[model samples]
Target: MDRSLILGLLIFLTLLAMPFALPLIGQGYLTGLIIKAMLLAIAAISLDLLIGHGGLVSLGHAAFVALGAYAAAIALQSGIENILVLLLITLALTGFVALITGSLALRTTGVYFLMITLAFGQMAYFTLTSLAAYGGDDGLTLWSLATLFGSNVVQKGNGLYFIVLGTLLASWWFVNRMSQSRFGRVLRAARDNPERTEVMGYSVTRYRLVAYVIAAMIAGVSGLLVMQHAEFVSPALAAWQRSGDLIVVVVLGGLATRNGAILGAFFLVIVEELLGSFIHEWRLIYGPLLVFMVLFAKGGLSDLLTSKRRGNQVA
Candidate 1:
């Protein structure tokens, strides 16, 4: 087996152990934090599939996340109880929206693509705010969460944590597998030279659209999990700021690298939590920290971990 696969396996093992280990140390609350990070990682990994490999920088990815949450929340609010059914609803809504918006967004590239996605995302945000029945700007509180075949396991506690961790791991593996496939190679080719790829008879737009839909669907799943974990969601979940944060996580984790977004999510969340505990204006410190990392750490947090190993190999 490849060394990277071995490394990934070890990391998953550590994550699996944390739920059991953290409580013994009286830091069970950290499990929730881990769940949060994992949720973020799920979304980030999807975004990475777009920006890192497909070279499509979007500013509306979070719209899918919100759509997922809203779809599931509204379904449950209307008496839908089964987690499986809710997931199907969330995927359908998000996928449909992604298909429409991606078709329009794909008409542009580079900064224009970024702007168009932001526009679509804002459209989603405004639409969410208009749903007064769902609490509008105040957000909707899910009075009852989804259940797994009459089991509340996925709705709270360690069950929720493991579910999220499993999802994150699955996402990591899925995206990684896709990135190594022939389709991934073509996507990267389109990213590097579209005209050349078109000359080769590949439909660049089609490839990108598929990638967009895949990413959006993954993000939508993340949103559903987020809603279950928090039990509340607002239109703010679809905002451009949330999209920006996803971008930050992907970039800070290391574009096109396995485990980068996961590491970035954990790092960002832990830093935010630690800083917020000491000061109310942690954002005052946060911006510069990101700036420093972008300027100094070319490959983000993932590189910091493997740089030594790479160096020894080169030597």
Candidate 2:
């Protein structure tokens, strides 16, 4: 089997077993931690589609996450409790925002595009903070967890955890298929050399716009899961720092690999949990570690792990 495939399977199995296995080791309480990692992974995966494939680095992608969370939370407050309805509404809002922002952001390249996206993200963050009806700067807490067909299915046991796991798996599969499709090919080609791709008759901007919107919608899904899990919505979810962390996940995991997001999220969460458990000044160590990891781990953990496997196979 391909080394990457083997690694992917191992990661999937570990996540699938976490809800059961953690209890055996007395770490069952970490179920929520793992679920949170998976939820964040969804956002990382969505961001990867842009940074890794389309060569777009968005500093405001977390805005979509906040948008999705707030959209669902607001709906629930208005007496909408169905998860399906909430998800649909979340995606629509995220997509609309992505479309509007992406259309304008795509007109610029490199730093300008990055800045424009960042500006849009700040706009979103402030907009949410100004909505006094929704708790404004203080944030809004959901009255209850999201429901499925009028039942608290998602709130029961590992239901939401498994739901997030399944969604992550499905998203990974979808992104894999997309990365192999003709559209993926064009997007990648454009990323590597826009001039040549345009000469080949592909509209680089159009492909990028589509990818951006897709990514934003996926991030929206992550937001919904986050809101469901935390039972709260705040402007902090859309903060620039959250967006920075999403980028860190992508870069920390390895760019362009389907497994990067999953691996990175797990690694990040574990490191933070471990360090924060002991050190009050954890970021002092964590910050330097990230810089070193990016400096030495060229393709991040995913590529490093897969390459080691391939090397062992060759041996």
Candidate 3:
């Protein structure tokens, strides 16, 4: 097998072993932290599919996440409590929204595209805040936890952790497969040279729109998992700041690297947890930290770590 496959397997094994080793480490706190990291990792991975692979920088990705969360929450409230049903509803709603918004957003490019996406995301947030039936800005709580195959699967911490791990693994595999597929090649080609791709008879906008919708759908799955884990949904999920944070997580992990998203999520969440313990104003630190990251580590945390290995191999 190739080095990337071996590396991916190693990461999967580590995630699988985490829950088993948590109690022995006297650090059950780490388990919850890992779970949250995995959740964000899923989101980052989906965003990476667009930003890193498709060369589509979206600032409104969080809107789909919020849409998924609200879809699941509202469905559960309306007596649709099965996890599968909730997931289906969330995916469909998020995809629909993406389809509509992506068509319009794709009309612009570069900075204009970024601003349009940001605007749409803000609109979604405000719309959620207006839903007084769901507690508006206060958010809405799930009357009951989601049922998986008629069982309360999420009630078990290990069960929930494993489920998320499984999803992450699946997502990673799916992305890798897509990256190697014909469609993925075309998308990457477009990213490299859109004018040439257009001249080659490919509708660049159409391809990008599809990629945007797919990314949103994947993000929707992450949203479903978030609601299931927290048993709550709110406008906070859709906030523009949340979208910014997601972008940060993706970039900090590394652009164009599959594992970077997961690594970035883990790193950022751990840093937040550690810093927040010592300083109540942790974001004060986070702000500058992000600046330094973007300014210095252009390739991301993973790239910095692997640079020596790459150089050695080249030498």
Candidate 4:
């Protein structure tokens, strides 16, 4: 096997063993953190598809996440608690919204596109806050957790952990496949040179719109998972600040690297959790830390690790 395959397998195995090993290491807290990180990683991976592969930077990505979470919460309240059904509803809602917004947003380029997406995301957040039936700004509590085969699988920490892990694995596989597909090639080509792509008879706008919709759908899935794990859905899920955090994750992990997103998610979550445990104002510290990472370690934590590995090999 190639080095990349071997490295991928090793990472997979390590993650697979984490649930079994964490408790023994007295690190059960890390389990929840890891699960949250993995879900965020899934969302980041979706964003990377647009930002990294398609050169489309969206500031409204969290809107899809909010849509998914609210859909799941509403579905559970309406006596439709099946995870699969919730996911489908979430995907449909997010994709439809993406389709509408993307058509308009893609009309502009660069900074204008960013601002438009940001505006839409804030609009979604405000709309959710006005949803009195679902608790408005306070958000709604999910009275029941998601079920599989009539069993509350999500109630068990390990079970929910595995569910998130499975979803992350599947998402990573799908993105890897997508990056190598003909559509992916076209998207990359367009990113490199949109005018050339347009000259070759591919509508750059159409390709970007499709990618945007797909990314929203994937982020919607992350939102569903988040709601299931937290047993709550709120307007905060779609906050513009939340979108910024998603962007930070993408950039921290390194654009276009799938594993980079996963690593970035874990690193950010763990740092927050660990630091927040001791300091209530941990973000005060984290803010500068992130700035340092961006300024000094532009390639991200994954790149740092790879560089260290190469150094050791040389030594």
Candidate 5:
């Protein structure tokens, strides 16, 4: 019944009830918004694995999402309809690319690593744009949603919603476990003190490369969901601006906390929606809000919420 577990439980219940609750509130259009947030949260959480735990700041993380989406579109284009098969292909493709890029990127640290990731990302974006057969610069559209076990379950009512919710929960749990494992310890130690960790016999480069691959695979899964949800795969998914937003989501949520990504995703998407609705020039306000958060809320909203709970408990 501690704060962390309580927070986790609250998130779980809220998501579980969203589909039903949103409809009753006559704001069911928000369901799509929630799904978008959840999917983005998955990507953001994966990025957090690198940023928070591995201390790697990748500016091109969105490339993996675009890769996943393209993988799905390409697979379907090639006559593949099985959701499982598409996901496997997508994850494998993402893993392969991540391994190759990570091997090279991990050779450098700090700003060099960040820049290399960005380069790889842009390479992916341009490559997608050049794919004329699949819509290229205009992007490709799925004829329909991928079938699960030969059924249109994903295209049916609330089926995709529930599936996405399940995936998000599983991802949150998996990342949480990963952050608490011995491997997690090695990653954190390497992050805090690479030389000492290297002297202790752990291969820092290999650890980071593995983390990068895992994060990429997770982002790929989110891409799968995105393609299903949007029925469109565009090079825009791999744009540097998207990657920057993912980073913003991670930092905005409170780096290092298991639920921070989720909280940040909800906050970012909701705020954007509010601003877009109320102001013609939303970025003017949104940009400053991010700067304020970075300057004043070092731990992000997750930390802000937990602090209040701690104060209440102490009293």
Candidate 6:
């Protein structure tokens, strides 16, 4: 078997067995932590599509997460308890917002694009904070969460965990496929040389805008899942800090690598949990790790798992 396939199978098996195996070792509580990591992975994967393939640095990505959460929460508050409906609403809103914001943000490149994204993210945060009816700055605690055919399976137990895992896998696969597609090639062309791509008859901004909307929709799905898991929605979900973390995850994993975001997200969560368990100054340690990775690990942490063990091994 190919080494990559072997590694993938190993990862999939481990994740599938985690819920059952952890309980036998009295580490069942880690399930929630793993779920958190997976959710973050989902969001990070979406951001990766922007930063890696599209060469778009969006500081406002987490705003879609917040929007998705708030949209679901508010819908539940207004008596919409169906998960499907909530997901659709979340996608539509996030996609529409991304279209508008991306169209405007794509007007610039490099630092300007980054700054505009930050501005849009802050605008989303303030907007969420001002929603007095939905708990304002305090956030809204969900009394009722979305359900699949009125079943509570998705609300707790092993169901939500598996669903999230599936979503993570789907996101990884989707992004990988998209990255190899012709559209992704055009995006890459634009990213490498916009003027050249434009001269070749491609609309750089349009391609970027599409990528932005797709990323937002995926992030929104992550947001909805987050709200479901937390049973709460807050403006904090869309905070600029959260957006920064997503970027860190993408970079920490590996840019333009298929599994980079997943690897990065899991590594980050584990490190934080491990360090925070021992030291109160966990974030202080976080900075050094990034520096170390940047200094020593050229392809980011993903390469650690992905690269062949032997130098002569052909992948």
lDDT of each: 0.90, 0.89, 0.85, 0.84, 0.90, 0.87
Tens-digit lDDT track for model 4 on 132-248? 999999999977888886888765688999988898988888987897798898988888888999999999899889999999999999999999888888999999888899888
Model 5 weakest 10-residue run by lDDT = 306-315
lDDT score, candidate 4 = 0.84
Residue 47, candidate 3: alpha-carbon lDDT: 90
Give the per-residue lDDT of model 3 (tens digit) for 63-87.
8988998888888888997888888
After superposing candidate 1, which stretches have Cα over 4 Å from the reference?
1-3, 308-315
Model 1 has an lDDT value of 0.90
Instruction: Report the lDDT tens digits of candidate 6 across residue range 79-195.
Output: 888888988999999999999988888998988898999999999999999999989999999878789888878888699999899888898888878988999899888888889
Quote each prediction's TM-score: 0.96, 0.96, 0.94, 0.93, 0.96, 0.95
Q: Which residue pairs in candidate 4 have backbone atoms (N, alpha carbon, C) closer than 3 angstroms, thus clashing?
A: none
| Model 5 agreement with the true structure over 169-261: per-residue lDDT tens digits | 988998989988998899988988899999999999999999999999999999999999999999999999999999999988877786889
Clashing pairs in 5: none
Per-residue lDDT for 158 in model 3? Answer: 90
lDDT of 2 at 83: 95
Question: Least lDDT summed over 10 consecutive residues: which range in candidate 1?
Answer: 306-315
Candidate 1, residues 202-275, lDDT tens digits: the string is: 99999999999999999999999999999999999999999999999988877877778888898899999999
Off by over 4 Å in 2: 308-315
Which ranges in model 3 have alpha carbons more than 4 Å from their true place?
Answer: 308-315
